[model samples]
Target chain A: MDTAMLIEKSALVLLLFLISLGVAAYQTYFERKLAAWIQDRVGPDRAGPFGILQPIADGTKMFLKEDFIPAKADKWLFIIGPGISMFTALITSSVIPWGTNLNLFGRDISLQVADFNIGILFVFGVVSIGVYGIMIGGWASNNKYSLYGAIRASSQMISYELAMGISAITIVMLTGSLSLNDIVKSQHGMNWNIFYQPLAFFIFFITSLAELNRAPFDLPECESELIGGYHTEYSSMKLGLYLFSEYTSMFVSSAIMAVMFFGGYNVPGMDAFSGNILAILSIAAFALKIFLIIFVIMWIRWTIPRFRFDQLMHLGWKVLIPVAIVNMLITGLVVAWNQGWM
Target chain B: MSLQMISVILGSLTIASGLMVVLSKHPIRSVIYLVITFFFISAMYILMNAQFLAIVNMIVYAGAIMVLFLFVLMLLNLNKEMEPETTRMSLFTAVIAGGTLFLVMITALRDTFQYGKGYVQVPVQDAGLVEQLGKLLFSKYLVPFEISSILFIAAMVGAVLLAKREKQIID
Candidate 1:
């Protein structure tokens, strides 16, 4: 590859890494503030300038703290646990499309790290691998609570992931493409799939939340039952990696939802602009949509009470999976009819 | 030299781990080793230019199947003490079976193996397998698919019947 292309690829990777890290950091602060606002209380105003530096302070605290490994814990596996969690979280975002292609220095550049044709499937594969992180971490901790949490997490994720995959199948049928960029392009203008496949959208959105272990569906880490769940024994930056990965995955999921269903980067009259300003504006619009989606997730977390474990299982198997399957069938029928293949 | 050497190394790792999976006393540890075996097998698949199969192998076998194994192990509460020791005769039979299998595989490889004859590099078609697999599944494999659904329903019913609690009658 040419130097310029190599440079661009490296820059893209670096940019995505920084964006995920930054968003994950702020999401922690954002969740707290949202929770406080919903409960009618002041939140985090001491750190610097309206507590804008709170994440920094939190990072410092985690870093400066003493890292502890339990005496009975498998030290290598314990270390691998957080490493796997953080790695899977970051790698899953590689296939997500951030914006349309931009022309820079006489070369066209796509606003994605990779544009694999099986992008959606890749995401599913990576997300499935994510369970191993929790399972290993919990198992290696050598605590009963941790082990229970791990088992719960593995089962929960496996169950919810089926619904998520089926929901994605609906979109794949509608778009006739698995690439995230292609899906975004298909949803260009005012033709968002959300309008056509609202049921699928809802299933995908809810399942995405569950997959991220967000509130209401956060049974894996349900403090009331499992005592902080999977990461109960984790401390210092090991715990921070777990928490950061959760929020990062949340941020990436929000972005995926926006790109897949919300006409990503395509505002009304977006075609009217041309040149550098338009590119910048489009990227800004995409970022705004992602941020709004993240805010809505946090809002849901603060509003909804956690579900009973049995209720969560019932919703997954008896409700979401069947609904998703039906939606996929409908989508396939619609696509076939549209293509005159009936 | 390079491709052959890499394949040999990966193949050895895969076979060794596959053996470890069966030989390991601890069920949980066996599952872990089996996962590693799946990973090595996937790597071998990738080396053979079967990217789709490699990914599916990792996802279905290593990721999902082994997680199920680990989950079952955890649920059963089976640890080292719970596992039964193999009798000397059983161990001997297992070793003989393993040795015979290895010998057969080596002999088969010696007869069938060929290098660099018709190695055509096919263009990587994006979503090719997914599209073809979807067509084959919905059309040619429809009967099997429907049968599988019926099987799943039967299993669900069986599980419910087995797990249902019975209440004692008051005299």
Candidate 2:
């Protein structure tokens, strides 16, 4: 790669990193505020206007708190646990096609960091590895509750991942490509995958919720049952990293859902504009969709009660997996028919 | 600086981690090292421009399978005190097995070196791409692929059957 291209990609990477972190930080504030509003109470009103600065305050507290390690904890692994969590969470966004190309300084710059051929697979791989962060943290903590949480997290992620993969395969069949950019491009001009593959979208959405460990599936860190779950023994910035990674993964998964089912950065009448203005508008549209999805996720979190472990397993294995497989078979048949194969 | 240099570095690291996998005293640490070894092997696959292979390796081996391995090991909670005593008989058997495998590999690899074909080239530039791989699998390797898939199904069914039997016994 040329130096200029290298610089451009680095700049884009930095921009995405900042955007994800910023959105995740704000998500914490919004989650609490929404929860309070749902409960008919004012939340964090003491921290700036409408509690806008609450995340900052919480972050500072996390930084200032004692960085505690349990006496029996595996020291190096304990430290590496949260680091891995944050690393995996942030890197999953690398494959996301944020917007169309921007014409800047007489150069066409793609908004994505790396448009790998196996884009969706890359996301799955990162997410699969994401289990390690929780596993290591909980196991290294040497606590019974933490170990239970770790086990639950691993099995849950593994189970739901199968359904998620099958669901995504339906989209892959329809789009005939694994790259997220191509998937988004295929869905241009209101021809979103959700229109054709609603069942796949539903399955994917539910699986993403489970994958993100959001409520109804947040058994790993369920407060009442597991006492903060895998992160029970984590303190200070270590705990903050775990929490921050959750929000980051949430934002990334939301973006993935948007790109896969929704029309990504594609907006109605997008052809009306051209050049950098179009790129900016597309990005804005993508951001708006992502926020809408995130809001829905938060809404579900507040509205639904946590599922029991058996119920969660049943939903993933018995229900989602079979349904997703059937959906994929139907989608494949339809696509094959369209291709004149049957 | 070059791809070769990077590959060399990765190869060495992979070996080191692979060694650690067997050398680590703690079973959990060994599993973690095995994961690290899988990651290095995946990286090597990337160096070979086999992105699909690299990612599948990561997902299946490092991600899913290794996590299960780690889970079982963690559940067992095998510490220093619980480690099995290494008797001379078991040690001798392990050495014999390891040495026999080493000898077989050395003999197997010697033919390629003798033929001066130790360095093989990827026949197609995009051989490892998903499209090319899929086409090849469906066309050329279809029967073997189908057979392996059937084998996998059999394994999965057997596991489920075993679990169900155990549950019935408990009831």
- Candidate 2 yields a Cα-based lDDT of 0.93
lDDT of 2 by residue, A71-128 (tens): 9999989999999999999998889999989998999999998999999999999999
Per-residue lDDT over A171-215 for candidate 1, one digit per residue giving the tens place of the 0 to 100 score: 888888888888988887778878888898899889988888888
**Model 2 TM-score, all chains together:** 0.98
Model 1 error, position A256 (Å): 1.3
The collision pairs in model 1 are none
Comparing only chain A of model 2 with the true chain A, what is the TM-score?
A: 0.99
Off-target runs (Cα >4 Å) in candidate 2 are B116-123, B167-171
Shift in Å, residue B138, candidate 1: 6.5
Give TM-scores for every candidate, taking all chains together and pairing residue i with residue i.
Answer: 0.90, 0.98
Chain A vs native chain A, TM-score per candidate: 0.98, 0.99
- Chain B of candidate 2 vs. true chain B, TM: 0.90
